[model samples]
Target: MKKPFAIVFLLILSSCQYFEKQVPDEEALLQKRLKEINWKEVSSYPSIAECDAILDKELKKQCFFESMARLVQEKLDLDTIAMLYPEMDTINVQVTVYPDASLKFEPQMPPDNTVSYNTIAIDSILKARLVDFPKIEPAQKEGVPVTTQFILPVILDVE
Candidate 1:
C-alpha cells in the first residue's frame, strides 16, 4: 500500500512540471506580439472642429493638416520680423499636442539649415498663434487619447 501511494504522488508532481512549461512559452509569445505593434500610429489622427465632420479616413487626415496650416497662417504675424539673413526662406515649427488639448510649439533649426531670428519675436508670434488655437481633440490609439507630434513648414517670404 505504501509503494502504490508513492508512485501516484510522483506522477502528479511530474504532470505539474509539464503544465508549467507550456505557460511560459504562451506568456513569452504574448509579450513579443505586444512589443511588435507600433503604438505611435493611431487609428485616427487628432482632429480640429473643422475636421470633425469628415468621415473618410484619408479626407479627415487632409482636413486636419489644412486646418492646422490655416490656424498658423492666420495667427502668426510675419510682418513683425526683420530678417537678418536673406538665405533663410523657411521656418520649421514643431508642435506637440498633448492629450489634454494644449499645444507646445518650438522653432527648431534643421541639421543642414541655419536660422537667424530673435527669440523674443518668435515667442511673441507663437503666443499670438496660441491665442487663436482651436479646441483640439487629441489622437486616439485603441480608444485612448494620445499625445502627438506635428511638424509645420512655414515659408518665410518676407519682402
Candidate 2:
C-alpha cells in the first residue's frame, strides 16, 4: 500500500508541470510593447464642434485645421502685430494642445527676417486671443488622450 501511494504521488507531481517559465520578465515584456508604439503618430486628430459633422477622415482633418486657422485669424489682431513689426513677413507659431483643451504656445523664435518685439507682448497677444478658442476634443492613441502639436503660419502683411 505504501509503494502504491508513493507511485500515485509521483505521478501527480510530474503531471502538474504548470510553471514552465514562459514569461521571463514582466517588465521586459512591458518595455517591448511600449517600444512598438509610435509616439509621434496618433490614431485620430483633435476635433472641434464644427468638424463633428464631417464624415470623411481626411476631410475632417482638413476642416479641423481650417477651423483653427479661422478662429486664430478672427481673434488675433494680426494687423496690429504686423504694424508693430513691419519687417517680419511671416511668424511661425508653435502650439501644443493638451487633453483638457489647455494650450501652450512655445516662446516665439524670431524668424530669419528682421523684426524685433518684446516676447512678453507676443505672449500676451497669443494668450488673449486664444481665450476664445473653442473646446477641443483631444487627439488619441489607443483610445488615450494625447498632446498634439501644430505649427501655425501667421503671414503678416508688411506695409
Candidate 3:
C-alpha cells in the first residue's frame, strides 16, 4: 500500500512540471542555442526606437550582452513578458533573428471561444534593431561569433 502512495506522488510531481511556463536557465539555453546559429547572414530587424531605452550611448553597446549576463548573475526580470501579452501561450516563445537584431514574440490574439471556434490566426512580430552596432559576420571577426538580443514591445490591448 505504501508503494502505491509513493507512485502517486511521483506521478503528480512529473505532471506538475508541464504547468511550469518559465524556462529554467533561459539565458544559458539562449547562449547554447546561439552557438548553433550561423548569424553571419543578414536577417531583417525592427527600428531600435521600439526597444527599451538605455539611452547612454556607451551602455547601449552592452545592453543585450549585459541583459544575458543575468543568466550568470543573480538578477532576473520575471512575469515581465507575460504582462505585455496576456493571452500568449508562452511555452516556447519563438525568437526571430536578423543580422544585428533579434525579436521575441508569442502567439498573439488567440480565438474568441464564445463567438467562434474558427481558430483566429495571429503571428509573431519584430523586436528591435541595432543602429550603432554594425552587422558583423562571423567571418569578419576571423573567429568571434557576433550576435545581438532585443526585447520587442508587442502592442497587446484587449480592445
Per-model C-alpha lDDT, please? Answer: 0.74, 0.76, 0.39
Query: Tens-digit lDDT track for model 1 on 1-159?
Result: 999999999999888987766455788898998798687588778899888999998899889988886677555535443254456566677878888988888866656635445666676667765565769888887778889998887666565
List the candidate numbers ranked by lDDT, top first.
2, 1, 3
Task: Put down candidate 2 lDDT per residue, 1-159, tens digits, no spaces.
Answer: 999999999998887787554766899988999999998788788899999999887888899888876776655654466677666556667878898878776546575455456778877777766665778898888899989999877665544
Off by over 4 Å in 2: 1-36, 157-159
Better of 1 and 3 by lDDT: 1
How many backbone clashes can be found in candidate 3?
1
Clashes of 2: 0
User: What lDDT is obtained when candidate 3 is compared to the true structure?
Assistant: 0.39
Model 3 Cα lDDT, one tens digit per residue, 12-75: 9999988987767988998998897666642322223322466554455455344433321211
Query: What TM-score does candidate 3 reach?
Result: 0.21
Return the TM-score for each candidate structure.
0.67, 0.70, 0.21
Residue 34, candidate 3: how far off, in angstroms? 17
Better of 2 and 3 by lDDT: 2
**C-alpha lDDT (0 to 100) for residue 91 of candidate 3:** 24
